[model samples]
Target: MSCLKQTVNVNKAELMKNYIKKIFAMLGILLFKVQGQIEDRTLPTFATYPKRLKINLPRNIANPQHIYIGDNVKFGPGCFLLALTEYPTSKMRNSEFNKATQKFNPVIKIGDNVTATAYVQISALERITIEDDVMFASNVFVGDHQHGYQSAATPYKYQPIWKINPITIKKGCWIGQNVIVMPGVTIGECSIIGANSLVNKDIPPKCIAVGSPATVIKKWDDQSQIWIKS
Candidate 1:
């Protein structure tokens, strides 16, 4: 009788351990399903979901449908792409908002083979076009709108008017770290913008520009086949 009781106790212990294992397995599968659903929500917005288009998590993409990305575009963590469809009210227009709004459809079109590092922000109020093979270093900001600060007495944040313009970064451009590409600016093809530069005006093609209000320091002379000082 004693032997029989000991056998029954051992069997009960084994059964309990198996039951706990099964519960944990089910929980893991449930968590995986939930995560998959979250990732799938962003898929419908893409124009074409090409293979190997990697985007790290924790990205802030507002109006993803209005933002079209081409093939082989990789975005690092903390990248924010804002494409606003309507005019933003005062309550919605602020640094925290990263707003982009226009009378027409505001679009952000990024071409193929583009790589944007961490904390790269592209805010399109009217339109912002980035051509193929463009690389943006960390903390690069591209915006196509500026706040109207004509009123001295009014607080800058409360200024109702948003000056909307369009920005275009042409093909084969490399924007260095902490560069701010402002409104109405067109960065010409194959241009290299230096770090900590502010691009307020249009940059000519095949030039190396650097400074607060970036000026062309050197330009490629096609005839000479070399970079000449500007």
Candidate 2:
């Protein structure tokens, strides 16, 4: 018995599709490596970073010496951290008068294991502290002071800064996207602030707050191991 050999046909479209996928995959890896190199150059400016800190490029970091970062703190792209030394308030009205005092005294202390996704801006005129294990979503703005709207005629940028109060976020808190945390606000431990919320007031520990002006919607009941209406 004689056996006949059958000719096999290869699909060109399938081969092209796989080749394209591989090209894209390689490009993605190369892009990330370049990004990592760029990000590393910005690390030296920080007051203290014990190797575990990660940050994406295009970071608007000013006075980074005052911005103390802890281990395992990862910041995504567009992370703007400014420890503002000069914000003209009533106390700092006279340049000559305030010169004797701390000419540049601004602090932004971020604890270990804190993570911010993208576009998280933390600007401190006095102090803005984020405790350990805190998570921040994109576009989260935390400021210890606001620019004075003393005169509508004058642009807000030209006006002096008012309400120079320190802000703090306790450990294990999750700050949602587009959340604007204003001056003197302290979010208690393990609390969750909802997206697009304006945190103008202090939120108690273990509470879920939401809205334009964030209000407590639910409270964690340790006894029942459930979240109850606040």
How much lDDT does each candidate structure score?
0.85, 0.87
Residue 21 of model 1, lDDT score: 97
Q: How does residue 157 of candidate 2 score in lDDT?
A: 58
Residue range 28-93, candidate 2, lDDT tens digits: 999999889878865657788556788888788878899889888999999999887865534446
Highest-scoring model, lDDT: 2
* TM-score against truth, every candidate: 0.74, 0.85
Candidate 2 positional error at 103, Å: 5.5
Please give the RMSD to the true structure for each candidate, in Å. Answer: 7.6, 5.7
TM-score of 1: 0.74
164 Cα displacement, candidate 2 (Å):
0.6
Candidate 1 runs further than 4 Å off: 1-44, 47-51, 89-104
- Candidate 2's TM-score: 0.85
